[model samples]
Each structure stands twice: as C-alpha cells, then as structure tokens.
Target: MPKFLIQATYTAEGTQGLLEEGASGRRAAVEQVVSGLGGTVEAMYFAFGEYDIVLIVDLPDASAMAAAGLAVKASGALHTRATPLLTLDEADEAARRQVRFRAPGAQGPAGA
Candidate 1:
C-alpha cells in the first residue's frame, strides 16, 4: 500500500461546522471514506496553523488517493493537499537512480 500525508484547511463555514460537530466525527467520516476505497487511516490530528487538519493514511495506490482527494475537494468543506510518503528504503532507491541535471555554471550530469 502507498502512504499519504494529507494537509487540510477548512473554510470559515467548515470551521463553524467543526465547532458544532467535533473532530472525532470528521475523523470517523474520513475513515469511512478511506475504508470504502480499501484504505485505512494511520493517524489524524487537528492543528493550529495555516492548515487545520493533518492526516496520515495508507491506501491501495496513488489512484485511490487521487479519487479520495477529488471526492473530498468536491464536498466544498475542506481544501486539501496530498503528498506521497516515502520510506527510507524508497528514498535511498530514488537517490541511487541516475538523474541528469545542471547547476549554475556546471553544465553536466548531476554526479559530474
């Protein structure tokens, strides 16, 4: 399964609803949505910042994550950004890949 880190910010109306209903209800609702797509919520939390809520979820794949993002955005309650979470091994693998690039006056392969 692919993991995702979701940062969400609610609209003014959305916050009003949250104040009335509560975070647990919203968390349950998100869990239901994720479970329906063969995924599970790893962790969820409300924060005080530019983003109101943050969630870590494990889904079957990127497509499932996109579908969930579309659904949530369409609801018009919360705006969200989903970032794919990579494990340490995955990061190492990515680093090992032969990537070509140039920087400043150094016009050559990245490793050069």
Candidate 2:
C-alpha cells in the first residue's frame, strides 16, 4: 500500500454546502468514500488558506488512487492535488541508485 497527501480547495458551491452540513459531516463523508474504495483515511483536517482540506490516505495501489482523484474531481465540489508520500527507506534506496548523466563541460553519458 502507498500513502498520499491530498490538499483540496473547495469551490464556491462546495463551500456553501459545507457551511450547511458542518465539518463533521464532511469528515464522515470523506471517510466513507475512502473506505469504500479499499482505502483508509489516516487523518483529515480543515485549513484556512490556499487549501480548505488536508487528507492523509493509504490506498491499495496507483489505480485506486487515480479512481479516488477522478471521483472527487468529477463531483465538482473540490479541486485537489495529490502528492505521493515516500518513506525514509525509499528515499535512501533512491539515493543509492546509480544514474547516468552529463554535467556542464562534460561530453555526454560517456566522455566523447
């Protein structure tokens, strides 16, 4: 399973609905949607700024994540950005991999 951080800003129509439904209702709805997709919402919060909602979710796979994103977006209630989270071990492994490259003043992948 992989985790993602979702930052969402509500549309004007969504905000109006939020004001009427309240925060708890929103949270419960999110939880239901995530759980229904074989995912879990680790945490969710409301924020004031560029984003109105922040959610940490763990999903089965990339396809599941994509489905969730599409469903949310199609609702027209929110605009969301989903960032995949990397674990410390994953970061270390990435750093250990060899990458072929050319730098300034270098000929090519291999010196010409």
Candidate 3:
C-alpha cells in the first residue's frame, strides 16, 4: 500500500459545517470515505492557520488517492492537496539509484 499526506483548508461554508458537526464527526466522515476506497486513515489532526485539517492515510494506490481528492474537492466545502508519502527506506532506495545529469548551460558532459 502507498501512503498520502492530505492537507485541507475549509471554506466559510465548510467551517460552518465543521462547527456544527465537530472535529470528531468530520474525522469519522473522512474515515468512512477512505475505507470505502480501500484505504485506512492512519492519523488525522484538526489545526488552525493555513490549514484546518491534515490526514495521513494508506491507500491501495495513487489512483485511490486521486479519487478521494476529486470527490472531496467536488463537494465544494473545502480545498484539498494530496501528496504521496515515502517511507525512510523508500527514500534511501531512491537516494541510492544511479543517475547522471548536467545542469543547463554547464558546458559538455556532466563530469567534463
């Protein structure tokens, strides 16, 4: 399974709804949605400032995350951003991959 970090900012209408239903209520709704899509909500937090809610979830794939994002955004209550998350080992593996590259305007071969 793949994980995602989702950050959400509620609109005025959404904020009103949140006030009525409460954070736990909202969290439940999210969990339901995620579970329906074959995923699990690992952690959820209600916050202030730039973002109102943040969630870490594990889904079967990126497409599942996209589906969740699209559905949530289409609701018109809040805006969302879903970012794929990589575990430390995954990051280490990525770091170990071999690649040769050169910056633009840096003459000739990369090591030349």
Candidate 4:
C-alpha cells in the first residue's frame, strides 16, 4: 500500500457546511470515502493555517489516491492537494541507485 498526505482548504460554502455538520461528521465522511477506494485513513486533523485540514491515508495505489482526490474536488466545496509519502526504506533504496547525468552548462558523455 502507498501512503498519501492530503492538505485541504475549505471554501466559504464548505466552511458553512463544516459548521453545520461538525468535525466528527466530516471525519466519518472522509473515512467512508477512503474505505470505498480500498484505502484506510491513518490520521486526520484540523489545522489553523494555510490548510484547514490534513489527512494521512494508506491507499492501494496512485490511481486509487487520484480517484479519491478527484472525487473530493468534484464536490466543489474544498480545494485539495495530495502528496505521495515515501517510507524511509524507500528513500534509502532510491539513494543507493546509480545512474549517469550531466549538470547544467555541461556537455554529454566525455563532454562530447
């Protein structure tokens, strides 16, 4: 399973709905959506800054996560951003891989 971090900000109408339904209702709704997409919500929280809410979820794959994001966006109530989270082991594996590349202003192999 792949993990995703979701940061969202509510529109005026969405804020009004939030006030009416409250946080618990919103959390449950999100949980249900994620579950329907074969994912689980690891954690969710309300924030007081650039983002109104944040969530961590474990989903089956990128497409599943994208589906979840698109569904939310389609509601026209909130703006959402989803970022894929890589585990430390995955980072380590990436760091260990080797390849060849040229820096800016540099030529190709052997400077040819």
Best by lDDT: 4
The digit string of per-residue lDDT tens for model 4 on 1-112 reads 9999999999998999999999999999999999999999999999999999999999999999989888889998899999999999999998787757788787774322
TM-score of each: 0.90, 0.89, 0.92, 0.92
TM-score of 1: 0.90
What are the Cα lDDT values of the candidates? 0.93, 0.91, 0.92, 0.93
* Consecutive 10-residue window with the lowest summed lDDT within model 3: 103-112
List the candidate numbers ranked by lDDT, top first: 4, 1, 3, 2
Candidate 3 local Cα displacement, residue 103, angstroms: 2.1
Off by over 4 Å in 1: 102-106
In model 1, what lDDT does residue 55 have? 94
Model 4: lDDT to the true structure:
0.93
TM-score order, best first, reads 4, 3, 1, 2
RMSD in order of candidates: 1.7, 2.7, 1.8, 2.5
How well is each residue in 58-101 modelled by candidate 2, as lDDT tens digits? 99887888998999899999999999998999999988888887
lDDT of 3 by residue, 23-47 (tens): 8899889999999999999999988
Write one digit per residue (lDDT tens) for candidate 1, span 30-81. Answer: 9999999999999999999889999999999999999999998998889999
